[model samples]
Target: MRSIKFNIIVLLTILSLTTFAQTKVVSNSYSFGIILKIEKFAGRDFRYSLELKSTDTDSLKNIVIKVQQVINDDEWLDVNLAKDVTKDTVWHSLKISSKINPRAKEIWLYANFEGNGNFFVDNLKFEIKTESGDWEKFPIKNADFENNENNPLKDFRTNANIPDGSTIGLRNRTDSIGGKALLIKTTKASVIFKTNYGANKRIGKYCNINGIKIYYETYGTGEPLLLLHGNGQSIVDFNKQIPELARYYRVIAVDTRAQGKSIDNDSSKLSYDIFASDMKALLDSLNLKKVNVLGWSDGGNTGLIMAIKYPDYVGKLVVMGANLNPTENAVEKSMLNQLKKDLKKLQQKQDTESKQMTRLLLMLSTEPNINVEDLHTISAKTLVLAGEKDVIKAEHTRLIASNISGSQLIIFKKQTHMVPNENPLLFNETVLNFLKQEDVKN
Candidate 1:
């Protein structure tokens, strides 16, 4: 019976010690600014720490310091009130034991003055003790929650308006390839070559064929070179290489369907055939019988399709990060999540039609029909460029190069899916070299 009683007491003592160890407090004494208000805060949990340093009883009676919690704009909670004790210098420590609401966005410690008499407060601090879980900071700033005249969200959302075909303004500004702007104004003595072409309003003068508008911005005077952007990007994705490539060839950068200023129609019905047909239409519209093609990612896939389906229109094909197989499960899941988030936001803003279009585009982007067997049919002089870390595995790239008759393969060291964008200098140099080599061979 005695052992049982002793065990119960020991358990109680352990519980008490555990509770005490969870909270800590410290105090400091320093003077600054107004006497009626506390100037400097030094230690933690000062809200619970009370100090009285006075021998004269009359002077102490008029002093009062209250600690309050600012809950919101109009609400406050008074949690501490210090009492005077007889001493020239006195230090008091208090431990705070309270439950805090997990959902409360912000908590502020405020010192409230009661009487007009000068009251000095020094070394004030408050630390919240929580047993719940680790706190995660939200990305939204304090200014985002404010709806007044100085609110930043009003201007933020206004500037975030990314139209279908025009450039998508980067949120975090950088001079990187993905963020560079495309120069679109016409120059003097520009050659006008017009043909029967349906213009897509979104991507400014790019031709639409078989319900897909291929984005193409042209410059310089030479053999035509069709440029294709990678996934999740538009013509703007090739901004860095445009000026240089344009100097040598009549470079035409295209934003494939569902990416950058291009229309997102029935994405579910999308395939390389649709993209190839669109390119054929674009070529037919421009009255160009044949052209060199440079494609990145999905554009590479489209280029392969064009070479296979309409070999007459392709002069030389340079394909980068092109995948013969469908995207893997992990890649598909990540892509779907991003698409879902975008769709949700669009739906919330009453963009019902755009939501469906985006969904269709995602479905098309992940279609599993295209494979290595289909690539064997390509007859164009192909130069397969694969980034070292490209989403398309090395074996697949090798297979693509092997299957395509007399195709050359070049692997860019230490590169990824955005190799063209990430390493523009190397990408351009390699392509120019390959084209020159093909020229010699032909």
Candidate 2:
């Protein structure tokens, strides 16, 4: 009986220690922020700038600070926030030039820390550019962090619920600029800013393609360049490439049928051929004679079909992480297995959403059965790309490129199928270089 009682005590002690460890980890992770009221300067073009300093320069690599100019409760403006702060133990000036909404009622700022770090911020300044080409300071309360005399954290706010001690905290401290500064400290936490890409009315538009509406966004104006996203994704997937590509070409980013804002009510099974047909119809509606095409994954398959069936519509083609078939010879066995498992689960459900998902999965598993010899029919100058670790087999990608006469193939090293999203700068550069090349007449 004594031995059993000792064992129970040891088990209880171990559980207690485990609980304490978990609490300690949770306490170390938190997020904090502050809201500054600035409503007087609505409907004006202005430049927002701030000075920030970090104790550890390495930690700055993971910290995120987002500034939003809120307009009338729901409307908001995203400022191209400062991301070049690469210095430590010294102040760095971050500036952004953007126009404010005419109906803006308030502006808020939030800072998120990914790991244990401390940062100091001061001199939050906003300057409006006058019509006469002059800069004037807008009236802002506590523009500098030197007003908190009685309260060390008068205008500050944090997630720290404790009155005295917490993982996340705010306080006033003296800085090298000979003034008080707001000190924000956090142990660890994560915060992601929700971005609206597929639904941005600023650039989004729709055109009737067949019986369904196809949503697309256009930017810049040199030559039309169509961007097609992967399966189950929309314009949001190409958000990183659109703006940069827009600088050089007329970027036309489209939401494939049944995805994003292009809602489909038809109960038919999805196929790359149907998707390619929709693309051709969309280009026709836009009055585009011939345009360059950039496609990812499933979009790549659609592009291939478009080039095969409607060669006159495609000029230069770039396809990344695409495959000719749905079998293990094209895609990794593990990916095929996972897709089959997911499709099985979705098939058991009867909801509208589940049915839609089932269709997408079915298409991924059994469609795009392109014959390698069919690629020989493609006359468009093509650049085939895939990541070294992509779900699509490397040899399959090479086979597609080899079959297409005079095509170029590149495999991104140390990258997966998500290279376009994971390292967009490199991906965009490679794409731009290829697209800007002098075309050889077929």
Candidate 3:
């Protein structure tokens, strides 16, 4: 009986050694790949036990195993034995260990031949040896099968309790919050243009004003000119004319509220007033007493509001493709309705918040006040620009120029609403000529 007991102990020791072997090889090409599906777990360490057999010892050293989480397809983890492993016999066992994050739902394992060798595997096993405890719990409690619905949390004092209200509209907010690094000032640098010198530089550190953080870039040196962009575009939209405009004047371009790298706010409360206020805050933050303003599309309307409500902050104004009345175009009304419908679908889908914000901007952009008479009260030196093909007829642009005392009108012959982007050279030439005239008068 003692002899039999000793033999059993020896067999157990051999089994333990066989179980810990690290290399696995397959025999037939058809049976080469192995699929491992890990069970769903909030937090756990996944352990896999693999059995390997190689008909040719030369094949063991060339074995490779690929491991990856199933949900995100782009990333992969590779596991390899420390040394070459060749199997002369059948059913050699190996153990592999990996830790899965709390959020992981499933994982996969595949075995492949690194070279021409072949082998097979059986008696595969997987288990969770440990669990992660510090990981944050899912927001919803009792969210199990059949009842797995959740709602976003909101602060009533700031944002509305609506799930959509809590979302900030932006993608790549972390990376693009200040525009791409490529577009910003890296260090103190200056470029010399034909007539003037331009310096591409950042003006100030990021600051939160009225619950929004604003960033601005400045170019050239002369009378301050504040350039505002339309919806869905950042300050980068001025890249084409930055160098040229900077050559003549101190050109400052800004990423408006909830767009580009600017901080997002409650979408439900966002209106043109909020954007105008944000621009005012930026100017105040910069300590600029007054500036010449140039705005395109939504930016143009924003400039008009600034000139109307805070006339002291603006010296001269140039507005392009600006609508003085919101109800002038039926097409715009139809577009807004379509946008509202699309927004509802987006809310239902709970898609990216930035996409929703983009839709909202589109709706607000076309709702400009159409009454050109409003410009008559603006005291700043004014330039009304319209693309020959602008949705606002050339006659309407002339009407705007006529209303504002001493305001000049320029029409780009073949241009449309997108003059700055599509006809940078012509737009810059026209703007420079007007600014030069203003300089001569001053």
Give per-candidate clash totals: 6, 0, 13
lDDT of 2 by residue, 88-134 (tens): 66777767777766666655554443334566667777677777879
Q: Give the residue spans of candidate 3 off by over 4 A.
A: 1-204, 328-347, 354-359, 362-366, 370-373, 439-442
TM-score of each: 0.50, 0.60, 0.51
CA lDDT for candidate 2: 0.73
lDDT at 402 for candidate 3? Answer: 87
CA lDDT, candidate 3, residue 112: 33
lDDT tens digits, residue span 272-327, model 1: 77777888888899999679999887788788888877989999999987776565
Error of 2 at 178 (Å): 30
Q: Work out how many backbone clashes candidate 2 has.
A: 0
Give stretches of model 2 more than 4 Å off.
Answer: 1-111, 114-195
lDDT of 2 at 272: 94
The C-alpha stretches of model 1 lying farther than 4 A from their native spots are: 1-204, 208-215, 263-268, 327-357, 438-442
lDDT of each: 0.52, 0.73, 0.55
Give lDDT: candidate 3, residue 189.
16
Worst 10 residues of 2 by lDDT: 16-25
